[model samples]
Target: MVHKKESINRKHFLKDVFICSLGAYGGPEAHYSVFIDQLVVKKKYLKEEELVELIALCSILPGPTSTQTIVSIGYKMGGPLLAFLTMLIWALPVLIIMTLLSFLYQFLNQNNISSTGLRFIGPMAVGFIIVAAFRIGRKVVTDKITILLLLFSAFITYFIREPWIFPIVLIIGGIVSIVTSNEKNLWTPVKLNPQWRYLVAFVIIAIGSIALTFIWDNRIIHLFESFYRYGYLVFGGGQVVVPVMHTELVQLNHYMTNAEFLTGYGLVQGLPGPMFSFSAYAGGMAARGSGTFVQVLGAAAGGIGIFLPGLLLIYFIFPIWNKLRNIKGIKISLKGINAVAGGLISVSAIILMQKSGFSLENILVTIATAGLLLTRKVPAPLLVLFVLILGFSF
Candidate 1:
């Protein structure tokens, strides 16, 4: 259902994006649930199958998977312009908030702002993941083979817990499905007019930024290079990027203290939106010695740098992906790919529950959150706000 330019409700779409940003907590795992609720169920912007396919596609990509998935939705709904707006709407507010929060480290420390108020959030996010896994699982698990694949993917991911394991599992699942399936005549090729210019732009910026950093010895350029590298090189989302950032920002360059880096990370976990927004906080801290203006510049550079590669890559690849779907082979493969993706989400619930703990209160919060979401009587944004308020009250 492609919309004409004039027919697309740009305002409505952007508003939904903002609402998602405000309520998007946890990392990509939990963010998928929010996308399913707001974008898939409520808005009917896309089907669960299409969204799952996007999830599978983005999971194979290197950057923030949830961010890429949402951006792809915008591209599908409108065009590149709407996709750009989606990225901004989904990430900018938290970026700005994180940038400002970089200046509040001292105040937070002096005032003893414990993250206690945010404790329930982790379990709440687990709730979201549980519901998403259930919903996605119901849609994707169509046969005995798919059920086994789902369980296998979840079990393997739960134990291994490595970044590279994801794409490998997804690919293996795809191959397995194709080999075992009854579908014949699945490999017809279609002419693909991929926009290689976006790929060129991505590569040029990557190399250019690195070379410029070497030649300039400027702090801001260095920050951009570091983050742009992070955006492309890392497989998993913020969890994987955190250690890399810690090594570079704290240990290697001494850009910031370990304590400061951890503080920024903790704060980011409490806030809504992409976890990549932590880049702004780190970049701001990295430029703290320079000046206020430089710090803000550093934040903007970091925000843009970390998200740029993914945006470019998605823009370049999405069109090709859309075309490729016309191949019967690709359609057949989506079943296993989506099944494995569902498994990935399923394992995340277990991992997060372990991290969040198995206390009665935490379990109750998770149960309550999942229950309310399943009931569909409450809006996600309101549910999120209520949970935050409840957490703070405790």
Candidate 2:
């Protein structure tokens, strides 16, 4: 269904982007593996070592790994404009679907018809998170230090219930590595790649957003800042972004209730593009308080804000990726960051599990869902729909 070795034209890129988006619609692993095949196996776009470098970069940055990887490769192959267009193209489908799902989820919220569905979906999302933790953990946590870091990260995240805990955990891990003389290959700091315009713009936008948040207390500003912050901080893809958003939008701001967060989280599981599109769903839910006009604006702001920074960062960084990879400091810090990411993800799973209100019956549902995922018997979308219907029917 995917191939390379021939010169790729613009038409082919678009076609491949569309096809990859469809393939990813099934689940995170599916989308990523499909993309990996497209990039590494079929296209030979990037050598294995180069691809690993990109993977580490994605792991350190925020938002979805697959989406970021796609953008990074596109930027490398082309440039800033191409990368932006590529991300827009690859994410357009999911952005639309998630927006529609947001409308539906909002309708369900208003009518009270889908609580049961959300009930099933929410815990099942925890199951998904559990699967994600296992999948990523097995890859990253190979030593006692990482194991201890995972536990420590989880303990702090679960107890602190604050967003700063993320950076704090990363810092702690980095310091520990430095102190322990764990001169392993982690994030070796490097001179940020040039593209002075993009770099300056990124810095300005970041600072401006932060400054705006402090000066103004409007709904739109708050919403955009929330999305931007989540986009910047979340290291791992999809599932990991959940807890960060949970704390900011749900717990702190009351933008969405637990029900709303879990519902959006569970629902986005079936969307075809970036998992970050949940920001649209969340924005829609929050905008329910205002009229339709504000709702649409919120939706656009949420989705765009969630996506823009990471795209900028990836595009700007790609030109110098070769040089950046050689920095020993960045390499070691990345190891710390990755370890913290694993632990943070684990904590998010626990939080979701708790919020799902696991009773004996819920237990059965969770175990069954996890088992099904483990077996790989059904596609992700179908499995989600099955649970969704089961929720509505029961």
Candidate 3:
């Protein structure tokens, strides 16, 4: 009996470690395997079908599907503590890497090592942005109206040279959708936990900001503020956040040159994790001239600022989501938002394509990639590898 108990404890320990590691990697597949197996198979508390339903629900919601999926799973398995643990695990790697990179960039900047790299970053960045736009457009635009909206928005944005145009378009699109469609109940408040979660998130953020302020002596507060605000306000996905981050970091704070920022953006597109990791690159550049500690501190602050809002939003909104799930107006509003989201992505793709210098080779590569993505069971990383090889050879 004693031997069996020890073995059981060991198994549990291993299982927890595995789950935590998987959680640290924060992707849909990772979340599915690690959290699902642990919660359903090992715990044996929830049904498989229920787990599937939960996954589907998370998939439909905006934001990182994997993070939300894991959060839901953790909530089911062990309430708020587990949820926080799962989120922290998923966020840790990027945070650490970004922090380190920020420190390195700061050191390099002090020695003027960044200038040489900046030149090559420009054209590459344009290409990257174009690719991003193409990726988003291909996924979002299905209908004629959405296509029109995308084109109109793109033209207005390019011509007006205004950043606010995007949000204005979204709002107008939402209102137009409500007005034109014969659907009832077109607006719904997101379901949220009591204000307590928001309070907790705010407090945590405040403490972090204060701690960073004291530690780094507020050297890069602008960068920190921009990231924090962007993370908090950004509603759509990674692509939507791109423009906002760009405007703030490149245009507003002047932390990074356009070329440098674009290059970092391109690199991020090729990475496995969230686009928010771009914060690390930006923060690192911004902290140039600072010592290692300052660099890491800046990167961590920027990265956290970028992601904190999303985390808080999810925490606050989860409970309310359950309550509003059955509301008719909420359903209609979601449908409209989904439509607008699709349109927004399409617009982004067009902009990116123009910037990427789409040639026959790239077009063909994109089509092939799209086909693979739509039909084959291959993973995204593998697909990216295949395209990279093809692009290199062609």
Candidate 4:
């Protein structure tokens, strides 16, 4: 068992986080699988149960679920400092790639570069989600009530497909678990000394940024406010946030064309790490007036702005999570929450598979990817590289 408060090696933990970032393609659902493979299974930094709790907690909160979940793990390992570094290491590379891609979009267009080489990534991600669903499902689905809760959540989310549905379903799952369970004396109050300073900082930045946007006619301030708001307001993951961004950046502000925004999004899909990194591309493109430096600055603003609130929330809440979990009611509810989370992952694989197409080759790639992952034979990065090569070669 990994002990909290510096019992773990900070460097090694950060290195494993970097590895997860490199292999974390797709959105949050698929990203969770990569976390499972690398952090829980391979590294044994935390047990599968702890990871599931983190996932459920992050899902209920706003911002990037996978990113927040990993940060929570970092928080568990070595507190806030390590958590900050984990967030940076997990997201910085892809943020950089997305920022550069924002500039390279023109070059790619000029060269008529085909994105066919990224064709298999979607299917490969589905494979990861499938394995994740299976593994998490086996652990979470222990009883009839839990099974029903899982199915109910999966069915609801699959059909609804909205940002609000996720938290609502998870809340319902917890409530149902509590109502139906036969446990007595579930209320045990533990003192929670939450760090209120972090929450105050979160609110101050949010309000201050908005106020600054109105007071000053600066593009960077406006971009930071916009992206920061997106960080806290949007639920689910990058997929949900993208449309809000498109509407604001494309339709409202005319920062870039729909084509440009979509192009950057397409590029982000092939890159590993948080989908929120697409904000860098959009912010850079939006700030495209003075020079490359200004654009890069905009990208920096975007990357930091979008991730900051979530980090702050983690800072405020995660310290008390263990205390909260000590309540027998909370512990009982987690079973349902974890099962519902598993169902969400399961449904994601189906949704992604439909989107990627049901072609024979796609099916084969997904099956092969899942098979390799299950066997623990091929490393994720190597698997990703091999798939990219196949996409490029044939």
Winner by lDDT: 4
- lDDT of each structure? 0.80, 0.74, 0.56, 0.81
lDDT per residue, candidate 2, 301-337, as tens digits? 7898888778877867777777776866655666666
Tell me the tens digit of each residue's lDDT in model 1 across 88-150. Answer: 999999999999988875455568986566566667766766887788789789999899999
How much does each candidate deviate from the true structure in C-alpha RMSD?
6.4, 3.0, 6.7, 6.1
By TM-score, the best candidate is 2
287 Cα displacement, candidate 1 (Å): 1.0
Cα lDDT of candidate 2 equals 0.74
Report the Cα lDDT for candidate 3.
0.56
**Which tens-of-lDDT digit does each residue in 38-85 have in candidate 3?**
666766545777677666555444445555665665555555566676
265 Cα displacement, candidate 4 (Å): 0.9
Tell me the deviation in Å of residue 189 in model 4.
7.2
CA-RMSD of model 3: 6.7
**Candidate 3's TM-score:** 0.68
Worst 10-residue lDDT window, candidate 3: 1-10
lDDT of 4 by residue, 119-211 (tens): 776577667658767877887799999999989988987787655566677778788899999888899768889899999999999999989
- How badly does each model clash, as a count of residue pairs? 0, 16, 11, 0
Q: Of 1 and 4, which scores higher on lDDT? A: 4
Give the clash count for model 4.
Answer: 0
TM-scores of all models? 0.66, 0.90, 0.68, 0.67
Candidate 1 TM-score versus the reference = 0.66
Q: Extract clashing residue pairs from model 1.
A: none
